[model samples]
Target: MNAEGKAGGFAPGVAKAEGALRALFPETPLQENDYLSKKTGARVFLKREDLTPVRSYKLRGAFNFFRKAIAGGATDGTFVCASAGNHAQGFAYVCRHFGRRGIVFMPVTTPQQKIDKTRIFGGDFVEIRLVGDFFDDCYRAAHVFAAESGGMMVPPFDHPDIIEGQATVALEIARQMHGESDARIGDSLVILPVGGGGLASGVTCYLRESGEPTEFAFAEPAGAASLQQALVEDRPVRLAQVDNFVDGAAVAEIGAEPFSHLQDFDARAVHLVPENRLCATMIEMLNIEGVVLEPAGALAIDALKNYAPETLRGRTVVAVVSGGNFDFERLPDVKERALRFEGLKKYFIFRFPQRPGALRDFLDLLGPEDDITRFEYLKKSARNFGSVLIGIETRNRANFDVLTQRFDKAGWAYQDITENDTIAGFII
Candidate 1:
């Protein structure tokens, strides 16, 4: 079916899909958030898809895909998927729920926390295979294996059924908004995070088909803005490089099926969030709301920063909190990124004279509020000079400016390497 024809039937189809999903778990909450509302000057609500059994909305799509496949009496009853994150857990959960054997192919670089969770969800019903280092490698391997084994493949996104399944989120949003006294979805703006575009595309298509005058915005990781690139180029294009920090949404390319539904959106409507800046949002939610959000999960909420408070004033806005499968082990990295993004932390490489009190002299240049977080002697670069790596944290960003002026006056040969991606990647 054509995209338009498929979209025409989405309202009823999504309603049915959402009804069937209740057998597995109740609908996720759509709660009003005062913290966000006050920050943006908008009446903000959060569609909490993070509360699902697999801690992601991926479960809805996986369940619907399996449910339809079983009903159609197709093949030998085994299903397969390739995912390094949320989709794998969702697929595994559905596999066990349906009592069907399944195979999950994940990149070998996937964190053990995610791998262990997928296994626990699927239990004995699913077998996991660690494939290559990247998702594309595992994806190709899964397809070849499915072809040879005659097993059906359940895609992470891209398939029509998966899109329809994800549309249920919007279906519930519309109903829930109506129940909240005089709140109409038609007058609201919905913000969704874009990865391969399943959730965003599905939600937008369903809401559009419902004949609501709803506005929409999209969020994508700045490091992997595939949907924004597709909107600009008028076709889905593979990104040359992707930062996997936001692993759940760092798709190299937007899925063709999802792009078809999303292509008409203006590139301006899509906000590209920096990976470092996203960490600040995650920490904000964690500390203030006691809400844990994975990097990709925080995309929608972080995009709110792109809007001026006056622009969103008095408007009803909904931001989808997509997932919360955070591994606590990454907290230090997250905190480091957040501090850097906030400009309160920096790193520098200094050429220090191999003489007495050189370290004391450098320390004397620092502001009262500046604290040395890291200091290491890399090597003796010359007979009289050694290379020292120094990290500093301060109460204010302006302190760095004063410190840099002191470095120049004191005749210190130094390179600010905080923003140097290559150097920071290697040494930080």
Candidate 2:
């Protein structure tokens, strides 16, 4: 397809996206982040899509697709979309703006906050359908609904229109750099977080076409490295098992349309951010910079650790902060995971003597910095020995090393299962 045919607009997809998006809101900011720069020894810029009204870049594509669908005479039927988060919100907002009806299908497990927000946006113009327990199930239900109702289904990031629309982010990035572009963008390294590969493909293709000579790094959750898996096999491949911790960017497979533009990118360019480390980023950004990032939004920020200090020093770089749809209820879990990842916390099944002063003796070994977070007796083995679950937190990570050393010297029998997910998940 020609450029216009592929992107569904005359002025190029990015340009068309820019023109079409003005009706909704101004472009997201491209601001230099001082805190990251200080820590990385590089000039750090943030593509602040997280500050959007819908708190995501998903709105850009949703708006563009809605405009084109209407222009292409798709107004006769209600627009349908399958999404639980930002995409659903964007679609609902666009549907209302155009005075068109929309049908949104979400996983039944979707948080109430998202469902409430989507409903609020669509108002009388939309209908919410809780379909399946997973995304694929909801997607299938959405397609079925569209076919049965003669409505068009608006994809989250797989469609050409969506890619072209999402490419507008790069256009805004270019403008924000005062036209000098990213000579200082840290050797043209733009770290992007990938979900269905929409933003990465769109931005990379635009920058390359503009002859920006930039380098692209893609970060996906370790649980869902769709782009990496796709590049490894030379095609999009579905993952049998996925960890959905990074809910914003966890996809079983990269979208075929988005992957086409990204096919040439090396698989090595993709970085998988650990789910626990991502939790650390979320907590750090919130506490240090007042930036609230969801797991997917923290991807690019977490990738900063992958580069050497010399590689990024004095060079300007950009990390796309994707979304901020974080629920407050998850804060404790986030903190727990972050502490565990940072080695400030540990869990073990310690063998304890049921003799008198046994607990007192163990407490005497603990340093002033050591605090017991959890203590439980699992089984009554005998009068001499009993199984106990113990969690210890310390002010310094090294303190745990000292504490454990003392335990070994004293002939303490304990099994550290802190890093064992199977054991931790079941008990903790």
State residue 93's C-alpha deviation in candidate 2, in Å. 1.2
User: Cα RMSD (Å) per model?
Assistant: 1.7, 1.9
For model 1, how does the per-residue alpha-carbon lDDT over 246-320 read when each residue is reduced to its tens digit? 999999999999999999999999999999999999999999999999999999999999998789999999999
Q: What's each prediction's TM-score?
A: 0.97, 0.96
What's the TM for model 2? 0.96
Q: Please list the residue runs of candidate 1 whose C-alpha ends up more than 4 Å from where it truly belongs after superposition.
A: 1-8
Each model's lDDT comes to 0.93, 0.88
Write one digit per residue (lDDT tens) for candidate 2, span 84-185: 988999899888889999999999999999999999988899899998898889999999888987889899999988988888888888777755554443
Residue 207 miss distance in model 2 (angstroms): 1.1
Return the top candidate by TM-score. Answer: 1
